[model samples]
Target: MNIPGELYFTKEHEWVRIEGDTGIVGITDYAQHSLGDVTFVELPKIGADVKQFQSLATIESVKAASDIFSPVSGKVAEANKKIEDDPALVNRSCYSEGWIAKIKMCEPSEKNNLMDAAAYKKFVERLEH
Candidate 1:
């Protein structure tokens, strides 16, 4: 799994890359791998309000459909239209071009609830066993 050290992770397998008050969110590499080849991504509407740990988007793959939860509470600033047009981008490069949304954080401090790469790596290990 490509777990970038700078990003924060959630137990539900989403990642957040915070830049100032905006946070870029995506399903983790582990999540995309588990779901198999992605076929669709249902993006949240721009300007929509979302809460931490709540469902932010949905993804469908050949194997299953899964809800993507927000790693931090915020307003949906943007959704990656690339993934909408080519959901396979999720399987191709989940951490980069496949990112799902960008949120304008309501409270940056809520990021403290998330895990670092090391912690998330352990979390994924636990799930594998």
Candidate 2:
């Protein structure tokens, strides 16, 4: 339920912390909570091309496995290797250390397609009910 004010959110429950031409991406707090303890994270490879709303990676939790979609078109810049050994980092620190990938956005304007903190908080609240 922790919806940060600065990052953008997707309907599928991914978030991107926009940083200049780079975007740091991860599953939302709500998503990790819904998925339960994450057991695996299939990170996208560095240098791979990805499109907004496309499958960026996959995550497996005790409850179920789910796709992590990209929030913008980009080339993968870095994948968090720490999660490979301890996926629970996602459960422990999803907004910081547990971030899934860093992307070099090909189209920054695509961010407008995503929701801001206010909208996404409302969106998640609706889902909760």
Best by TM-score: 2
Which stretches of model 2 miss by more than 4 angstroms?
A: none
- Reference-based lDDT, each prediction: 0.94, 0.95
Q: Write the per-residue lDDT of candidate 1 for residues 1-129, one digit (tens) a residue.
A: 689999999999999999999999998989988899999999999999999999999999997888999999989999999998899999899899999999999998898899999999999999989
Residue 83 lDDT (model 1)? 90
What is the lDDT for 14 in model 1?
Answer: 94
List the candidates' TM-scores in order.
Answer: 0.97, 0.98
lDDT by residue (1-129, candidate 2, tens digit) is: 798999999999999999999999998999999899999999999999999999999999987888999998999999999999999999999999999999999897898999999999999999999
Which numbered prediction scores highest in lDDT against the true structure? Answer: 2
Q: State how far residue 47 of model 1 sits from its true place (Å).
A: 0.5
Tell me how far the alpha carbon of residue 77 in candidate 2 is from the true structure, in angstroms, after superposition. 0.3
In model 2, how many backbone clashes occur?
A: 0
